[model samples]
Target: MKGSSKTHLRIVFTLGIIVLSIYESSSQFLNDEFCGNKEVLTLDYRKKPWKGKNQFLLDYLKKIDYKDNIDSVRFRIPVKFWIYRNDDGSGGVTDERVKVFMDSLNHFHKLNNTGFRFYIREIESVNKTKRLNLGYFVEAPLQTIFNHTKACVNIYVCDFIKKKANGATYVVRGTYNIVTKSVMLQRNTSSTGLTHEIGHYFGLLHPHRNYKSGKNKQESVSRTRAYKGSLKKGLICERNGDGLADTPAEPRLNFLVDNNCNFSGQALTDNWGDHYQSETNNIMSYPTHYKCRNNFTLSQKSVMLYKASENKYAKYWNTKDSANKIYHFDIHEPDNTVKMASIIKSNEKQNHTFHKIFTTGKKGLATDKTDWLKFELNTENTSNILIKFTPDKIVNDEITITIYDEDNKLIKTINTSKQIASSQIQLKTLKSGWYFIEINKKQSVSKKLYNYSVELIIE
Candidate 1:
C-alpha cells in the first residue's frame, strides 16, 4: 500500500510540472512599482540627467533644417495604456476615467514650436491572476519588454503594486522603467503624479536627483563634492545639479507651501557650503501635494523634446500615419470587403496597420481573414501601374493577395513570400474609378497584425 501511494504522488507531481510549463509559455510578465500597497515608485536617481539633450537636438535638427537645408519633419510620440482588469476578469477603469488620465497627461506640450505630442492611442486589458498578477514581485525585464513593446511607449495601470501583511495597501502612485521605456500608475493616481512619472520617462530627473539621506527638518544640509548628492560650482556652470543650469542646485526642495504657493526655502547648502537656491515652479521638483507641481523649467522642456524625438518606440510622431491616429478611437478603419474599401489616389499610399481592424472578411480559406485597400487612377493616360504590397510582419508563407476591379469583380490572385511580397502586380481596370485589393492568409492561421502598406505607382 505504501509503495502504491508513492507511485501515485510521483505521477501527480509530474503532471503538475507539465501543466505549469504550458502555462508559462502563454503568459508574459511586466516589472513591479511599489511596496505592499504604496502609491508611488521607489524612485530612481537621475544620473547625467539632460546630459546630451539640448546639443543633440540642435545638431541633429540643424543638419536637416538649416545645415543640410533639406526637408523638415514634425516629431510625435505614442503611449500605449495597458489597463489591468479586476482579478475576477472585469475590465479596469471606466472610459471617463481613461479620458481624465489622457487629459492630465496632455497638459505638457512640445517645445521648440515643433508639432510634437504624445498620442494615447491603444488601450489593452491585462488579465489579473496569480500567473500574471500585479501584487506579486514579477520581474519582466527589457528583452521581454522589447518583444511585446510595439513602436510606442507603454503605460500600465493596476492595483496593489506592493502588499503588506497588515490591511494596508501600497498603491504605486506612478513609475517609469527607463530601460524598458514603460510606465506604471495606480488606478487612482492623480494627473500631477502621472505627469511627473512621464517626465521621468522623458529623462527629466528630480532637481534633487538621488539625494535621499538627511531629514527634512534639518533646517540646513551639506554634502562634499565626493558625496553622492554633491553639486560642484564652477566658472562655467554647475553641470552636476540635475544636468541643467536654469534650475538652481538645491540640497532638496522644501515641500511646505503656504496659501500663495511659494517656495519656502530652508536655506540649505551644497558640499562646498554654498547656500542652495530654492525652486518651486518646476514639475521636476518634488511636491508634497500634486497641486504644488505645475511647470517644467525651460531647460527641462527642451530635454523632454529631445528624448521624445529619439525614443526607439516613438516613430508615429513625425510621420503622415499620425493623422489617422489622432483620437483615442478612430473612425477611419480598414475596410475588409472588396466593395467598402476607402478611396485613394495613385500617389497616395495607404499604410494603416498598427491598430486592429474592426471588420474582416474570409476570401481564400474559410478561416483566412482579409484586409481590403482601394485606389483610383482617373487619368486618360493609362500609365504603367505597379502595385506594391508589404505585410506588417512575417507570416507562415500563407498569404493570398487578390485584386478586384471597379465593378467589384475579382481580377488576379497570387501567393506572397518574404522575397516576393512586393511583386509587380498589374490591375485590370476597365474604367478610371476605384479598384479593390485584398490581402489575407491562405488558411485561417495568420497572427501577423493586419497592418500592411499598399501603394500604386503610375510609371
Candidate 2:
C-alpha cells in the first residue's frame, strides 16, 4: 500500500489474474418478472456518485487549473467473490451460475467499453462460525458478516434466508454495502439482479427513485433523498434524478418490449407531472420483463468510468496491461441451434421433443434466445393442433410458447407458469402452410438439462 499508486499499477501486469482454470462459454439469463419485476433491483447510493458537475476529482483539479503530475489510466478492475453456506460448509453456490453471471457480464462490459475491464481475483468460501451465525441476514448483517479485503470489489452469495421484519419479509436478492464495498446476493439470483447491484457499486441510481415503487412500495423501504427535480432537470446529478441526462425520469417500470427490443409504450409521467420515459435496455432501470434488459446509456458509461477512476482501485488505475484477459468458461447453450434457430420435426409417433436449451442471447435480439420449430399442415382443411409440455423434472417452471404464421407475423404467445405434468394449447383456427413455434424458459436452467415433448394432434 506504500508504493506509488501509478508504479504499483504498472508493476502488477506480471502478477496476472488468478482464478479457477475451468471456463464456460454458454450462460443463462433470468426472466423479467415485475413490472418492477420480481427480480429486485437495489443499491447502496449513500456514497454519492462521482459524475456530478462539481463532484469528480478531475473537476476539483481543473477548478484550480492543475496539470498532470499524475497519470490517469485505469487498468483491469479486480473483483473478488464470496460464497456463504451453512456452519458445516454446505450449500456452496454452483460454478454454472457463476460462469453465466460473469461471462454474460464480461460480454456486456467488453462491448460497452466502460473504459475498464474486470478480473475475478478469487471466490472464497465463508462458513458460518460461532462468532458469526450467518443463518439469515438480509436487510443487514449483524456486524459485516465476513472478513473483507481492503482492495478489489467483494460480493457475497448466500441463500434466500431472511426473517420477516417491520411487517415485511426480505427475499435478499441483492444488496451493496457501501461501508465495505461488498455486494450480497441470493445464490439463485439472475443477471438482472447481479448487474443492477454492481451498477450501484459503480455509482448508478434508479431513474424513478423519487417516487412510485407502485405495488412494490413495501419493498422500496425508504424513498431516495436525491433532489426530485421537475421535468427537464439540470445536469447536476447528485441533487437530481439518477444524475444522468440520457436516462428519462421514469414514473415506475413498464419493462415490456417488442420484437425490435424497443419499449412497448409511450413516456409515462410521474406524479410530479415530470415527463418520464421507459428504459428497457438500461442496466440501471428495473425492467417489468426479463431478457429485454441490456446496455447502459452513453452518459451512464461515462459516469461509471469516472467512478471507477476513484481511489479504491489504485492498483489497477495506473497499471497498463498488454492484454485484457477475460474469462471464457464452458457454456451450456443449446446445440444444433442456428442463427435462425433450430427446427422441430415430428417423429414416427408424430411427437416432437426439443433437446436444445433456450436462451435470449446477448443484445437480447428478437429471436436471440428462442427455439424455433417449423410445422406443416398436411391436410387441406384446418387442423386442430394441440401443443403441450410433458412434465420433465429438469424443464423450467415457466415455458413461453409463441406461434408465427408462414409470413412471420406473430399469431399468439402462450405464457404458461404452472403445470406439474402437462400444459396444452389448442390451435383451433389455423390454415398453416408452414407455421413456426418458439419455446423458451423464463427462469433458471441451472441444471442445463432440458426435457420436454410436444405433440400436435389433428382433430
lDDT of candidate 1 vs native?
A: 0.51
TM-score attained by model 2: 0.49
lDDT of 1 at 169: 40
Task: Give lDDT tens digits, candidate 2, residues 1-459.
Answer: 656886676445212211100010011012222211112233334365443342454454454343333323344555666776668977667655665566666666655655444445556777754322232332234223335654566777766534344455445456555434566677766676766777777766666554433422211211232333563222333334565545655544544456566665455544434443465777776555546667776556655665665655443333443221111111222211222333444431222223221122352201113445566776453646776656445434667878777788887787766544676777766774777777766544332223555665657
Whole-model lDDT values for every prediction: 0.51, 0.50
Model 1 misplaced stretches (Cα beyond 4 Å): 1-73, 110-115, 129-147, 163-170, 212-238, 251-254, 313-315, 319-459
Give the Cα-based TM-score of candidate 1 against the true structure: 0.50
By lDDT, who's the top model here?
Answer: 1
Candidate 1 deviation (Cα RMSD): 13.6
Segments in model 2 whose C-alpha atoms lie over 4 Å from true places: 1-73, 129-140, 143-145, 161-166, 213-238, 254-267, 271-275, 321-459
Residue-level lDDT of model 1, residues 217-276, one tens digit each, is: 111222222223345222212234455556655544544445466655555454445565
